[model samples]
Target: MSRFFQRLTFVLAATIFAALGLGFALGEFGMFGVHAGGEQDGAYRQMHVYAEVLKRIQSDYVTDPNINTVTTGALHGLLESLDADSSYLTPTEYKIYKNRPTTGVAQIGLIVSKRYGYATIVSVIPGSPADREHLADGDVIESIGDTSTRELSLAVIRLMLEGKTGSTLSLSVVRPRKPDPDKITLTRTVVSPPALSEQQYENSSILYLKPGELTAARVDELAAKIKAAGKTRKILLDLRDVSEGDADQGIRVANFFINQGTLAVLEGQKFPRQTFSADPSKFLTSAPVAVLVNRGTYGAAELAADAVEDAKRGDVVGERTFGEGSVQKTIEMPDGSALLLTVAKYEGPDGKKIQDEAVAPTVIVSQNTDDDIDADNPQPKQGDEILNKALALLKAKNS
Candidate 1:
């Protein structure tokens, strides 16, 4: 038993030293933008601090601690500190990620991201399990089944939520109105993307289009609708609850309205800056436009909202969008663990990184109009305030 303890201590020390060396090398390569020798020295000092902390933990802890578990958690924290999208996948987690099915995967229909060191719901697809359970944007998921989300990487949290059809996922959720966490069980199902909904308001003068997902096909449908509307009807794009879809498709949707100027820019330490300019040929709409957004709007939807707002092309109405726009590069470690690092981030036309600073609405309107919630009447009041506000703004605009 004493020999086992000594072996464990030696292993922990070696792991810590290895991590320190990797950190130093990354700093030397300007990964963290530390080019100065003074910064390098400071980094080395921090590494020693880490070593001291590990030594104290092994020597003074009341009970025998799992050194391997501690090391794994440290690596998870190291990657997560960079961004919500970047994650550290352990060997087992990486194996699952690599073997995850391309199609026929079941899910509860929640778009999730890490915020405040916990897994947060970005959006719940309409008619899906999560939406049916009344989960809303900004809701914090404290744990999944027996595991706390704080100890799990963002990649693992996402994987845990998906499984074979009919599989059950248990969750402890913290809602804004509820003080205590709610325990819920969800059965995973294949959630189909909501179809593009089009409606004409104000005697068909304002064309309202709501796309639940920003796929290439959806954007193509949007273009077809705009072209078919002719020169009479104005556009009111509803991007609320849009969290899924390809990022490039979202940029293409922006080009439908913006004929000129820089739409978005991608840049990183090693990645060359690439500017995405609007193509005049893709510009299908010259009519007055307004875009609706909410906390559920993320990734590609953020790109569209930011483009419109920055181009001064339309009024962006509703709450600030959920920020999420970055490209990740997967790096596999020698031990079979992997790192998903943010290689580049997308910036709005105004030079603001969408992932850092989410798109703010030009016209701010709360999704909930009710100032107080009645316990007896838990059901929300009828009518969408965000849509109404956007329509009002579009009604006042000239074609």
Candidate 2:
């Protein structure tokens, strides 16, 4: 963008932001006892600056500028400045985004992040093509479809992996052990994440329960697992890799353990204080439980961990969880563009926002990246560092 346009866009954004009505910001976050006139004075001063910039651009610019482009780009950048999750979709992107079906899309089912100048697979969804391909944690995906994943944003890399069902993606991945990257092709399909899995060490009272991505139905499945684990001396609830589930379902999962008290709290600028409390009738477990978390543990799973740790009902044993709980409001612009803005955030029992601060584990046992973690048949046994630590804690408490 030209300097003239850039200046115009910046001024335009400042004006639009003022016009958006920040009544709550002033009332909730600003200095108390400050008169409304004081706030108006500040806004007027900024508006005056905006006008000056616009006037200079209109009179002295070398070429005739497109007002529409300038305004749109300004608004786009303004939304983006709000947060990483906030995005401005262009009209073309909006069309595809809105038309996209909620039915599961074809995806490699990897939670990835930028690491070592490439998209690294943090975890793979069990039963998905990525899991079946034996993609392990800490595996850095060097390239996708001939383009280096390093050249793309994590979001773009994820989009490239997801499409209509039956689509295929070729990946060049470098496992921590491999000296050379391995070339692999995975065919995507609807991945219904396994809700819950249960296992007991042979001739041991230690029952391990792993709740996969906390989908709506998974809550019931988890309750059943807890019920069937009946009278187990020690319980290990593996929340590692369990993220991206419904907020309400997460509260439900917490409710299963917490008889009463705040399960989760939601607050925002426009949104009211909505506190979800536990339902005593839904309480499912009083047995000592241990929660295993990692950077991959997100969304609903994070909430579940928050409850378990806060209520003193269980010990969280693993690495810090990925803070992913938030309420996003997607506003469709008049031009068919949209802004996905975070309007509210999930708060833990102690009132810390989940999306801002990760839930720290009581016992921080981080996994060795190269350690073997069996995804297909997850039975946390000896040498499974995080789970073993969790088991030891639960057992010590049980005895």
Clashing pairs in 1: none
lDDT of 1 by residue, 271-333 (tens): 899999999988888888999899989999999999999999999999999899999888777
| Clashing pairs for predicted structure model 2, backbone only | none
Give me candidate 1's TM-score against the actual structure.
Answer: 0.89
Which 10 consecutive residues of model 1 have the lowest summed lDDT?
Answer: 371-380
TM-score of each: 0.89, 0.77
Model 1 misplaced regions, further than 4 Å:
1-39, 369-382
Highest lDDT against the true fold, candidate: 1
Q: Residue 125 in candidate 1 has what lDDT?
A: 78
CA error at residue 184 for candidate 1, angstroms? 0.7
Q: What is the Cα-based TM-score of model 2?
A: 0.77
* lDDT by residue for model 2 (282-303), tens: 9877878888898888888899
